[model samples]
Target chain A: MKKYTYTEKKDTRSGFGAGLHEAGKKNENVVALCADLVGSLKMEAFIKDFPERFTQVGIAEANMIGIAAGMTIGGKIPYTGTFANFSTGRVYDQIRQSVAYSNKNVKICASHAGLTLGEDGATHQILEDIGLMKMLPGMVVINPCDYNQTKAATIAIADYEGPVYLRFGRPTVPVFTDPDQKFEIGKAWMVNEGKDVTIIATGHLVWEAIEAGEQLAEMGIDAEIINIHTIKPLDEEAILKSVQKTGCVVTAEEHNKYGGLGESVARLLATTQPTPQEFVAVNDSFGESGTPNQLMEKYGLTDKDIVKAVQRVLERK
Target chain B: MKHTTEELEEIASQIRRDIVRMVHGCQSGHPGGSLGCADFFTALYFEVMHHSTDFTMDGKGEDLFFLSNGHISPVWYSTLARAGYFEASELATFRKLDSRLQGHPTTHEHLPGVRIASGSLGQGMSVAIGAALAKKLNNDKAIVFSLHGDGELQEGQNWEAAMFAPFNKVDNLICTVDFNGQQIDGPTEKVLSLDNLQAKFEAFGWHVIVSNGNSMEEIVKTLQYAVSLTGKGKPILNLMSTQMGYGVDFMMGSHKWHGVAPNDEQLKLALDQLKETLGDY
Candidate 1:
């Protein structure tokens, strides 16, 4: 197993904020809209630097989507930020007709996604966002692993035209990826290599997979780690290559197992190679008012869970 | 500026003829609301709105319009074709395969004169408010226009947008409600009473205006007056009163025709009452 040294820890939302400011400097047509979550989504930097370009849309998420879509009509690229819950489920129709079907070049930046949005409970923690977003046609879905990668993905999506859903988390996690690494939309990153098992993960679970890889090394179980940042356009080549070597898979994510990263990988493997797989994900249930760490443990989404899943998949193989 | 009653009536008849022909050729579309809003649609496209035939989605430096009640696409398609946004013959391909004219107004088809998709009511107002704010940001002295149905107000998102527009100083938007008092279910009053609509908009800090939507002269004057009230501190809301099924005697005063297409005999009767000013599709 390979070891990565990290000196800093940061939330992915801050990366989005940094990317948004960089986009503002790069393009004058880039505008932002926040639905009363400026401080929560870490969009204050963009607001402070480009107050004229940032719009405060109050608590109206539907109106924010429409406004973002409308802003694109005048050759402006509008990025809307809010909680993942309010961003997708609350305003699916607004995004469907106004942004998706209308072909508006709007970037929907969603923060505090999945069970990682702790303490706010089930109402705020949205585990079904990936399902809702992926079902929409012409929508690009990107979920970055760490702070540096999230910021890079945000800046990258701004330059890429069309509608995109950039999802990030609120908890501070290990920032292991190089700061200068170029973020690609559909390409996956290979963190480590081994020949026993392949561990594919996304979002906050990337770090967990790395930790699981370390534990597996101690038990003589050499696990390969793959970071699947883009959920929609799964890195099929990377996944299939790793599976060809390992012959088994373990998928992890801080989302529901029913319609999340795990299901996507399972579906791909079933069709392409038919490999045995285990999932480290939340069961079919909503979250509770606990801390993010506690929820991760309770919902079987911790490092130990990934390690166990890797072991279980090896047994199946 | 005042419009003569004879001239206003002539435009109404021509618009009605277009509506009947467009809906009949499509064979599947909502004709009742199109006939109901014929007079108002004619007034805006022909007499009131200062838009050019060379259309673009980014409606900069000109008044913009969005159709919230996009189910009544027959009227909008006919009006857009007659106003020279597209070829008048395109109305024949409405709701058919490969036609730019979708069952609902969509920008995906690259339809001219449509800035956004709108079949899912209650979304156009928010889009209009956004465009209005963009106009203010660009320092362009142009008003944003939107038309929504009375029943579409039931979508809670409309109230969210209704509360947001005035609070955010989106005053360049002029929104008109087709208070035709009907939806697909039944009478709006019996289905869901939208009483005190004027008071509702007024309470939201809007400059509320009322007019008879069926009268082309009233619609033209009222829309002009509404446009004159732009760039103020508050958004403008017009509760234009109209009959659900107007122009056609059998379809009049009913909600049954809200989404139903007119029969061949009914189409003939409607065309007979409305003389064709421009060539029919």
Candidate 2:
């Protein structure tokens, strides 16, 4: 297995803030809107630098979405920041009519996604956002893995035309991956290539998959790991190629098993080439208040969970 | 381009004819509010707004209009065609398959005049404010205008947008409500009373203007006055009052025709009531 290490740790939201600041500097037309929680979303730097272009929409997520859609009319790329729950389920109609159906160039940036939202519990933690956003026509759904990847995605989505839902998390995770990597919208990043088994992961689960890959290597089981950041436009070619080589797969994500990356991968395999697969995600149930680590462990989304899923899938194969 | 009050009235009569004809042609549409707001649409397109007949989605350097109450798309389609945004013959394809003229206003089919899709209520105010803010950002002197149904304010998103515009000081937006007091179910007052709308807007820090929407002269003058009130640090709201069905006498002031199409006899009677001054499509 390829050794991966990080010199530091950082929350993905800070990466989003850093990326937003950078995106604002690069494009004068890039504007940011927040429905309160500027601190939680880590958008203070962008707001401080580009005060004129920033709008503080004071807890009104629906209005924020509408305003962002409207801003796209006159050639402004508006990035709306809020919790993943508020960004999707709360203002779905607004996003549907004003942005997706209209095909507006608006980036719906959501932070604090999945179980990593921690003590805020199920109310703040949104596991079904990917499903909601992906169901919309012309909506680009992205869930970047770590700090560096999140920053790159934040800046990259600014240039991509049309509606995009960029999902990131609040928990501080290891800063793996290249700091200067070019973030592609629909391309999958091949983390480690092996032929024994395939491990597909997204968001916080990518790091866990890496850890699981290291463990699988020690047990004399070679695993191929792929980081699927873009959920909607799934990299079917990459998944099919890896799964054909491995003949078995383990899908991991910090989301519900029914609607997240696992289901997408399963559907792809079922349609193109049927492969034995195991899902390492929360079963169709809500999460409770706990530390990020505890929740991830209790809900079966840790590195150990991935290793177990990989073994289970290998048995099936 | 400018037109006299008489010319505007004549154009509005033609628009009313177009609205009834388009609804009758489709056999499915909202005609009551469309008929009610015909004069206001005519006034805005022909007299008040400084817009180009050659439309672009990014309406920079030109006054832009959004129909928030998109159920009344018949009026807007006629207004856009009359204003030369597209050919008048396209009006015949309203609500038909593969036509740009959708049941509600949409940019899905690349409609020339529409910048955003709006059929769901209470979303237009935020969109208008955002566009107005964009104009301010680009340093463009153009204004953004939008029309809404009075009953549509029942959605909570409207209040959110209402609070946001004033707080952000979005001064270049002029939004009008079709205060017809009628909706699909029944009268707004009986359904849900929007108590003292002027007071509500004033409290929200918007400059409120009340006008008779059915009269082209009053609507044009009121819109002009609303325009003059811009750039003074407050978003303007025009509460324009009108009957549900202003042109056809049988349908006037009733909510029954809100989303119903006129039959053959009813269409003839409506055409008889509204004079086709500029000729039908």
Q: Please name the candidate that would achieve the greatest lDDT relative to the true structure.
A: 2
Best by DockQ: 2
* Candidate 1 Cα lDDT to native: 0.88
lDDT of 1 by residue, A85-154 (tens): 9999999999999998888899999999988789989999999999888888998889999999998998
Clash pairs for candidate 2? none
**Candidate 2 chain B: 10-residue stretch with minimal lDDT:** B1-10
Docking class of 1: medium
Number of colliding residue pairs in model 2: 0
Please write out the lDDT profile of model 1 over residues B1-281, one tens digit for every residue: 33576766776677778777777776677878888898888888888888877888787898889999999888888888877898878877888899999999998888889999999888988888878777777778878889999999998878988998888888888999999888889988898899999999999989999999998768888998998898788899989999876888888889887777777997898778787766666
Error of 1 at A45 (Å): 1.5
Task: List the lowest-lDDT window of 10 residues for candidate 1 chain B.
Answer: B1-10
lDDT of 2 by residue, A77-115 (tens): 999999999999999999999999999999999999999
DockQ of candidate 2 compared with the true complex: 0.88
Please, what's the RMSD in Å of model 2?
0.9
